[model samples]
Target: MSNDDGSMKELVEFVAKALVDEVDRIEISEITGNQTNIIELKVAKEDIGKVIGRQGRTADAIRTILNCAAAKLNRRYILQIIDE
Candidate 1:
């Protein structure tokens, strides 16, 4: 029932790859809840720029997609981008 797992993975990869030259070692975690879904992302320092984009436009877009997707499922989602 968690198709978003794949969606989460895709989104993570997209952001990570866009922000960094390397594609490996990108980690994304999803917390499912009746009230809201939380997505945590961990990326390498070198690739942080790609994840955040110029003025965080890329990050904003990713969050928007997550919010939209979760809303379709009658839920709320939050994307938490962490540096680790």
Candidate 2:
């Protein structure tokens, strides 16, 4: 992973940890591609709702932040919240 990828992973992890009750259960994985990067986030079953928020607004906000950061690097980022 490139430094940008690592920073993106850290950004997701940091946000997820702040939103969830089970911080230790949070797991973040990144799949880097030529033009796009996928960041997969896993949290405890009970904390899924917190990360996603009502009507997915919180999740959307996170993605917006990620996209803004990715824009500076000329990349696209997708954040996938995995409940399992």
Candidate 3:
């Protein structure tokens, strides 16, 4: 993985872990492409709403941050939240 992918994974993992009760249950993985990196965040089922937040405001905020950070690296990132 490139530095951007690694950083994106860490960023999402950090944010999600902080919002959830089951920190140990948080899983973050990245799929990197030529132009985009997909960051998948899996969290405990009960914490999905917390990560997503009311009306998805939290999720949007995360995406926005990812976009800005990816821009600094001249890459693109997509964040996907998975419940387990």
The Cα error of candidate 1 at residue 75, in Å, is 1.4
Give the higher-TM-score candidate: 2 or 3: 2
| TM-score-superior candidate, 1 or 3 | 3
lDDT of 3: 0.88
Better of 1 and 3 by lDDT: 3
Q: What lDDT does candidate 1 reach at residue 1?
A: 42
Per-prediction tally of clashes: 1, 0, 0
lDDT of 1 by residue, 3-77 (tens): 755576576557566666656767888777778667788887777777788999988988887767666667677
Best by TM-score: 2
Residue-wise C-alpha lDDT for candidate 3, range 14-53, written one tens digit per residue: 7887789999999888887888778888999999999999
How do the predictions measure up, each by TM-score?
0.77, 0.96, 0.93
In model 1, what is the error at residue 26, expressed in angstroms?
Answer: 0.3
Which segments of candidate 3 are over 4 A away from where they belong? none
Q: What is the C-alpha RMSD of each candidate to the true structure, in Å?
A: 2.1, 0.8, 1.0
Q: Rate the local accuracy (lDDT) of all candidates.
A: 0.73, 0.91, 0.88
At residue 17, candidate 3 shows an lDDT of 76
